[model samples]
Target: MHTTTSDTAPEQRTAAPRHPVARAGRISAQGAAALVLVLLLLVVVRLPWAGDLGMHAATVERLRHGLLHPGNPLIDADTPSPYYSPWTLLLGIVAKLTGLSVFVVLRLGALAGLALLVTGVHRYVRTLTAHRAAPALALLSLLFLWGPALFSWSGFLGLNSLALTVSYPSVCALGLTFHFWAWLTRAARGPIGWGAGAGLGVLWAVILLCHQFTGVVATLGGLAMVAGARPARATLLRLGTGLLPGLLVLWLWPYYDFFALFSAGGDLEAVHRSLYRDLAGRFGYVLLGVVALGFRLRRDRRDPLALFFALGVLMVAAGGLTGHYSWGRALPAALIPAQLAAALQAVSAGRWALRRGWACVLLVALVAGAWTQAGTLGYVVRRDALPGAVAAKYREPWAGYQWIVRAGVRYGDVVMARRFPARQIPAYGPYTVAPGYPDVFLPDADRREAAMKRYFEAGTGDGERRAILRAYGARWVVGGAPAPWLHKTAVGPRGQVLYRVAP
Candidate 1:
């Protein structure tokens, strides 16, 4: 009997345990407890409430109240919001099942996503390393060194500071992106079959539904995975067939919106800011990866990690040249791939150092120090906002707006305000707000912003303000000072008045 090398490879691979139960049993009690404690600390950390989170919560509220018959609940006659999201669906389900407020649900969702992301990354690192100790060390490094800068290096995207403040959809989408990569890598390695292919498509669809850009990156990474795996024609055909669901999602609604997104140019200046200054604010793990890559350690030629790393570097370069839409929406997602490669390098280094005595200790200490520094930076970013699930406690900030709502401020009623919090009144209150545009994706946003400024600060008298407001269908004025010419229906705690404007 002739035995080929391939005949014994399967047996050897099967001999290596990959099951969660098998892996869990190998975890030290102390390590498990420490992980639990760290997770708990992350959960307990204060999550701030800001306009974006509030807007998402409000949108979820609309979804929950009319789950069976849904419309764009946030849009009114004055403000047209043609927004669609799968995050709303997830939040609606949680809210319906648990009967919790959208605020609480968002917090829970963010925490869950974060936990999954950390675990998924840890598993990914373990697969890349020669020793299990490397995974543990890498996990610790991620926790301490990972700064929450969501977009560029500046912590401006609310990372470390306002990360929890962004809509849970984006955060959950990011987490989904990570898992999507992991699952795709597995399917790519397996024998091409209906199950694997269909699963890939389904996961791709889910990731797209969760967040569009993250979905695109997932798709790109999937393609890269296919290219790296270099499967047979039959396998490639099966995989293509499996990805039908994802194609269907694009065909359904995403294609139209996606086309619209690109039709309007991105913000190149924002890209420059992120690449030159902001991209370095968080994720010290990136530096570790660069240093490790410099070591020129031999990596597997077919390693998906290499492809992902190349893709990430490509993203940074491309991200810098694209407009705002690409920069804000698609580019930041490159962090997932970059982190994956960096983490692999970091873990490999740890595994290498295990043989070199105390060098590993010194390296870990450096990472720990970097984490401490990142934490300090995070504190500076988040210090202005109150913590602990702002959605649940948002009423304090919305007190003035709530008063206006209680005063019978009708739906579609437009109010003008220039203040930051004033702009948020529409999301928190029952009425619409005019000269208060929130969308950055629209092509005419610059025009609308300029028009809004003209309506507020540029106007000299009540006649000018009234004419401008009337044109946009403005019927109220929400601000710290009342428009003396208009009738004040209510005055809020901070002396903010909701004045009734006549057509």
Candidate 2:
């Protein structure tokens, strides 16, 4: 129960004026943050389609049906998958016990993750600064400090990204990461019992098991915390002791080999290339935070935020230089520390005039960032109902393959689809001939991809197409054309046809 307080520096203790105007500003900031959270809650309830929603839902479905040995999440194969994370397992249990649909379970998970994120931010910020406004400012900065291109990725914690991926394991992992740092901050500063150390280790493992990429960010943050504290040898020993349980958990996780992923990076590097694109448009605004980080480093070379930022930059730069784009997932590590530093600098002890000026600049930047991501409103509102300007910001989510489900595609049925539809069909219980996403462990993933390609190729013979269908045991095919081997079952939106594989 030992909790860390904001005792690192005198600047952290600076208090805002008790003047009514200043008080009003603090209340307003908190209110704005609350409003944003409410908006996100509405989004969770609506559950707008984007990114990997289907994959996550498919994971829950698999676990709900067979928790102990849920096979491949997307394809009809008996293979372990990385998507079978601790968070998804819990959701699966809930889905089974309550008999709730996977999407409903996902909504509940999103709410839980959002709550964890909000509370974790509050707790972690308190360990950094005592200013009442620091937590709210930090939360706002974290959400709105990115550049204007509206990048939305799983591990990226920007407002648009979080809105789209609030239900993902990455969000839960990030929330847990904040709590881990808060606990680590206290443990590093003072002594603790062995039990506490072991618990910390378990928590670390859970975060890693929840989302591997976010786990990297968490690891970097932990290292920065310990390095900055210059803890006693006893403290470091306890930390080392804590690490054992974490590694054990990683080794024993039954869903997939966590350690094997290190060598599996080759398949992921190509898909993650997008993380390195449009640097200025996607993250240029964070430079303001980099400026703040510079100020922290000047005050104390061992500042945890400064060290955190440096480590993140090194990892991301190394990834970009070495063609290891998967490492780009760690961008949030650098982005987060910088964002928090900017917020802290705005509220830290300074000349009244200087603080006020910094606050104004931050406020303007936040507003601009918010505007850039206004498209997030599309999730909660009808896109057509929105004004043309707002509608323009909206990125349409996929219409989904539920139509085919209505056409009698049942659980365990194999469906042949192109990559895009394949990504979505598995969410409803049916499996794709090939996984829509990358699968490093699936030994025949290349063969499956090739077979799917041949089946769809214009020059493919009827005999070869039938052979491909027979090889994968596909019961249904989703495409625009009908062949002699296909019996048309149903027509979906956008001229999509669902055809039964004629036996």
Please report the candidate that would top lDDT against the real structure: 2
lDDT by residue for model 2 (279-368), tens? 999988899999999988998899999999999999999999999999999999999999999998887776777878888899998998
Report how far residue 377 has shifted in candidate 2, in Å. Answer: 0.7
Instruction: Spell out the clash pairs found in candidate 2.
Output: none
lDDT (Cα, tens digit) per residue for candidate 1, span 178-273? 566656555555455787788778767766766655666666666766665556666667788987876676457431244344444334344345
Indicate the worst ten consecutive residues by lDDT in candidate 2: 1-10
How many backbone clashes does every candidate have?
14, 0
RMSD of 2: 1.9
C-alpha lDDT of all candidate models, in order: 0.51, 0.89
TM-score of each: 0.73, 0.97
TM-score of 1: 0.73
lDDT of 2 at 139: 94
